[model samples]
Each structure stands twice: as structure tokens, then as C-alpha cells.
Target: MSTSTAGRPYALIAEFETPASTLHAAELIRDAGYKRWDVHTPFPIHGLDGAMGLRNSKVGWFTFLGGTTGFSLGMLMIWWMGKVDYAIPVGGKPLFSPIFAFPVSYELTILLGAFGTLFGMFFLNRLPRHYHPLLKHPRFRNVTHDRIYVVIECADPKFSDAETRKLLEHAGGRHIEIVED
Candidate 1:
């Protein structure tokens, strides 16, 4: 609830001693109708996603679309080069044969699909983020160790300093901090 000199809150970070406590806190936050919140732990906790009301990721759709585009483009290029534009008649063979184009088309599909998966994950997850408000909190450094933390952004419509602290305490959080930007 504390604010910086400009009267804008950076973030609220609550520390928990164990994963169980953190998970419980996440459930409480979710039920409390807070949207801009996240939990941090040294390791992934089972059922955390469901407790946080997270939906399935959309990265797979990107991969599928990329592969489809690559396949279609490869087939079109082969047809254009071999049958339509050049119209090379080699040994009286068919101009556009599936057997001849399958290898290159398959390779392109796999290559593009792999690229799509990598880029989609990075884009969707907002990777390469060098800074975050929570990173300024002293205790947040323990996230890579044995500590668990939950952070609620001030951007949430229902956020209030007193109510957030009470919610964290009710969910078994301690050493709560009001981090600044």
C-alpha cells in the first residue's frame, strides 16, 4: 500500500516460507478477484496454474500456422518452377508429382514449425525482459533459492494496500514488502 514519492505504487510482494503456503495464497488471491498477480517459487508447484485460473498457452497454434504456410509455399514453388513457368518435360514424366516435391516441402514445414515454436514462446511469454519491479525487492532474490513469493500489482482494479496485506496474511504470507519502481 505504500507509495513512492510520486504517489504511485510499484508493487506488493509477500514472502511465504513454503510452497504449500504460497499455493494457498495464490488460491486466495484468485478467489479475491485480483487479476494482475503472480506467484514465484524455486520450483513449479502442482495445480498452481489451475489455482491461478490460467488458460492453455497459444504457442502451438503459431507452430501449426507456420508449418502450414511453409508446406503450401513449398508446394507452390515446386509446381511453379517445374510445371507452370518452366514446364520442363524431363523423360516424359509428369510436370508436378507429389513424390518429387514431398521431401523439400516436408523439410521446409519442419524448419518453419520449429522456428515458429521458438519465436512464439519468446513473444507470448514476453521474454528478454531485463527489468521488473519485483526485481528491486531485496527478498525477491531468494526466488532462485528455497523461498516462495507472491506479488500483486497495483494495477489491479480491486487493489488496496490494507486489503492486500490482509489477504496475504490470511493466506499465510509474511515479511510482506511494498516494492518501489
Candidate 2:
């Protein structure tokens, strides 16, 4: 979301020495009221979401809706097949029964719930991406090992090169550098 490809920077990235420093920087960024920023670390750090001001994910709603739809459809399909389509009564049992429908409904609930989680994540995170500007940075490759970083994207409305650099410096970030598109 950089403004242009004509030498505009995609983001500003800064390195932190430890998880504590990264977490502190994230809190500072959040307190500064800047959006469109993120933290990267070698491993998941405790309380990072709170530091970044993130709430619980909405993917659970998608799972609930999908499970409900699947359960309802499963019941309807069994009812239609048993009562209207064939209408065959076996051993004097009821033609449509909740007991019989439950197995299929449970299976469908599991299947659709899984699918909803997958697709919801793809939608929410903007998946199917083939590239990112961060991947072009030579030092960024160290993220998988021992490095922790905070990256503030250029697209943020509050982004200012000088102010953001100063903020990062104040938050204990080191090796701060602009990421060019």
C-alpha cells in the first residue's frame, strides 16, 4: 500500500534486542495511535496481542455460522430424503427422527467449521499474497532465528519519517531503517 513505486518506501523497520524490547516498542506504537503496524519475532511472545492493542479474532463467528448452517442443512436433507423422497418406514420407527439426523449433522458441523476457519483466516489476513516488501530486506531474514522487529508501514495515516524514527528510538529500537518499495 505504498503511495507509489517510484522510490517510495514501503515501511520503516527497526530491530529490538529481546522480546521485552519488542513488546515495549509495540506498546509505544499503540499508545502513539498509529495503525497499520506489526511486530515480528522469532517465536511467539506472551502478551504481544495486548501490547499491540489487538482484540480477539472474529473468526469464531464465521465458525459458528458455518456450523449452524451445516447442522440445519444436514437435518433438512435427512428429513427430505426420509419423509418426502422415499417415505419408507423401517421396523415401525418414525420416518423423520432427530436421533438419526444427529450423526450426519455432527459430521457436517465439524467439516464446515474447519472450512470456515480456513477461509475466514484467508479473508481476514488478505491471503493469496505472492510478495511482501519485507521479504526483500536482507536483515529481515533473521526473523526466523533470534531477531525481533517492529515494522510500521508507509500507508498509515499517522506515518511521518522523522516522528516515527524518533518514536522507535525512544522505544529502544535499534538499527532502524526505511524499507523501499
Candidate 3:
């Protein structure tokens, strides 16, 4: 609402009346070979990721690595503690049997996998962000309510003010505006 163009340009955003239109715009942006873009909706939209041409997240890899490390560490710790450091054999059972270590290793795998998921999410999302240019946009708050938005950052290599606006307009976007930082 301040209509002041004095601030540095950050992004170009457009409002869509419905999720379907928003999805269409996202597809157009994606096919245009633009990176550094995002869509905002009041709630999750099915197939939006595919529309935006996104690949699967890498968080699962982190979880697998963490779980593997945890299991290996748990098994090694149990084996070293029982078999080498202080051998404790009872009832003719082996000192470092995997059967005995299975429970703790499984628990450790679960614990560390959970941790990996948490940390991976934080890392991928760039969490703890206190500010963004969009956060200051007057229209952006509507995305938390009934509105949907598609934003293309100025930093995107394919971004051009006129052509991007044309694409959004052709894709049924309305009230297209430049967001500033």
C-alpha cells in the first residue's frame, strides 16, 4: 500500500484467486526455466511440487546416514564394552552377541533417525529466518488467509520484469506487483 518504489527490488509477485490458478502459474514459471521462485497458499495444494518442477527432498538421505551411524555405533559400543573392555560371560552365552545388542541398536537407530529428520528439515528450510522481503509486502499476508501467490525473485537468472509479468498475466494472475526489500 505505500506505493513507494524507493526500496530495492526483491521480487515480483502476483495474487491468484484460487489454488488451481496458482498451480497453473507455478507450472508456467517452472517451464520458463526460472529458479528462485515459490508459491504460497493458505493451505497445502496437491501436486504443487510437481507443478513447480521440484525434485524429491534430500532429507531422507540424512535420515539414512544418521540411522546407519547410530546402529553401527551402538553395535560397536556394545561389542567393545562386553567383549574386549570388560568381558562378561554368563550362562555360557557369548559376551558380545548381536542378539543382546539388537534392542539398543534399534532404539539408537530410531532416535538418531528422528534427529536427522529434524536437523535436515531445519537445514533445507533455512530455519530461524526472522525476516524475508515478502514478509514486508503488504499483499503477502493474504497468503495466510484465502489467497494464493506466486513469487519470482529478482535474482533468478531468467527473470525479466516485462516478460515475467506477461507470463503471470497469461497464466491468470492478477494484481501483479513488485516486492521490495
Candidate 2 TM-score versus the reference: 0.92
> Please, what is the whole-model Cα lDDT of each candidate in the order they appear?
0.86, 0.90, 0.88
RMSD in Å for all candidates? 3.2, 1.7, 3.8
Which segments of model 1 are wrong by more than 4 Å?
A: 1-8, 85-89
Number of colliding residue pairs in each model: 0, 0, 0
Models ranked on lDDT? 2, 3, 1
lDDT digits (tens) for residues 83-137 of candidate 2: 9999998999999998989999999988888888889888888987667788788
lDDT of 1 by residue, 1-181 (tens): 3334543567688888877777778889999999988888889899889889999889999899889988988899999999989898989999999789999999999989999999999999788777776776788999999899898988788899999999998898889878877
Off by over 4 Å in 2: 2-6
lDDT of 1: 0.86
* Most TM-score-accurate candidate: 2
Model 3: which ten-residue window has the lowest total lDDT?
1-10
The window of 10 residues in a row where model 1 has the poorest summed lDDT is 1-10
**Tens-digit lDDT track for model 3 on 1-181?**
2244558898889889877788888888898999889998889899999999989999998899889988998999999999999988899989988998999999999889889988988999898677777888887888899999889988899999999999989999989999987
The best-first sequence of candidates by TM-score reads 2, 3, 1
Model 3 misplaced stretches (Cα beyond 4 Å): 1-6
The better candidate by lDDT, 1 or 3, is 3
In model 1, how large is the Cα lDDT of residue 17? Answer: 85
TM-score of each: 0.86, 0.92, 0.89
